[model samples]
Target: MYNPTVARLTYRALLGRRRALILFALPALLILMSVVVRMFVGVDDRVAAEVLGGFALATMVPLIGVIAGTGAIGPEIDDGSIVYLLSKPVKRSEIIITKLFVAVAVTMAFSAIPTFVAGWILNGNGQQIAIAYTVAALVASIAYSALFLLLGTVSRHAVVIGLVYALGWEALFGSLVAGARTLSVQQWSLAVAERIGTGDEITSDVGLPLATTLLVAVSVAATWYASQKLRTLTLAGEE
Candidate 1:
């Protein structure tokens, strides 16, 4: 249920000047941080792991996900423009899926690519750390896109809610609360990365099997729910 037109429009809005600035900002910072760390700290595998894992994976990925995911549909919904899209011939599900696809693409581009570059810069791909965390960023992108796109459909305050969840719950509480870590997208992605990484430094609280299952489940469930929400918006459009 893909729609090219829906995808094009979603891409335009997300990559528009303001949103593009936010999307690019983190990746730039990550690269700069990598350069700074490299110049000052020199090449140490542990330091590389600390920078990429602590800042890149933990902070950058989720924040970019929040921006890309929410910006995909939130603006359209907020300004009543979604009614125009809803009134079109496209099915509600197609619209939701298309937006989800765009969101995932943007998140991956802004996050996964830079993560690899930064990883390379940090340690010249030592211990496969660059590849490992890049894999994590890619996996994390899909789940975050679906989850935050669903948020866009349901809440006008989706961005705010996402920020709180990303910075507060994820980056903070996830480290402290064992239960919170289990439910986290970050942890789930890290599980996959843990396998790819050679050294013992890369770790995850959740096992790979459990992480894969949860990632797939969350992405599918969120996309399905967002489609349902848009179907109701179809009726709202007709009114």
Candidate 2:
């Protein structure tokens, strides 16, 4: 579980100058909005739920997930720097696991912590809304990191695909079509939040058991598949 070297490299790559700014931007915006909303509208549980569910959970978490997850390995693979790691004696699984851990940690830092802060700002943690959504963000970080890390391993357009899934599929289709909600990461996460939050302020379309199952299954399957892909990854020789 501990791979200090790989973890160090992944953290540096993820929080590099340009990328670090993008990583922090959304959470900053969310907190700012919370402050603005609380100032003008005053404390309201419904508004708090909407702000957290609509913006923090729906938009910020997935986008940060895309950045952390794909960025953990995509850039290395693209620039052919991954060869340095692969050429070593380390197991491919170790490399994937280390990067996945880094991605999950980064995602939680950027998404979940800020979400808690924003939720509290929105409604003073009324009905335990802030804590509930924060839990959802934390749970989501794990699954999203695994899924997008796999995407980074297998596809050149990892970020684009992730954005499409996060924005188009989860945000758009999942909102318009009831069936799509059943398969959405956002909805699944909200299910967890629903269980934690008092009252029906933060409800989800999916049930708790189903959501928990999907979250675990997705995280495990994606991590396993990514390790397999990395094991057989082919690097082209310089011509």
Which numbered prediction scores highest in TM-score against the true structure? 1
How do the predictions measure up, each by TM-score? 0.98, 0.97
Backbone clash tally for model 2?
Answer: 0
Which lDDT tens digits does candidate 1 get at residues 194-237?
Answer: 99999987989999999999999999999999999988877766
- For residue 18, model 1's alpha carbon misses the true position, in angstroms, by 0.7
Error of 1 at 144 (Å): 0.3
Candidate 2, residue 25: CA error in Å?
Answer: 0.6
Please give the range of 10 consecutive residues that has the lowest summed lDDT in model 1: 168-177
Model 1 ranges with Cα > 4 A deviation: none
Candidate number with greatest lDDT = 2
| Full-model lDDT for every candidate | 0.92, 0.93
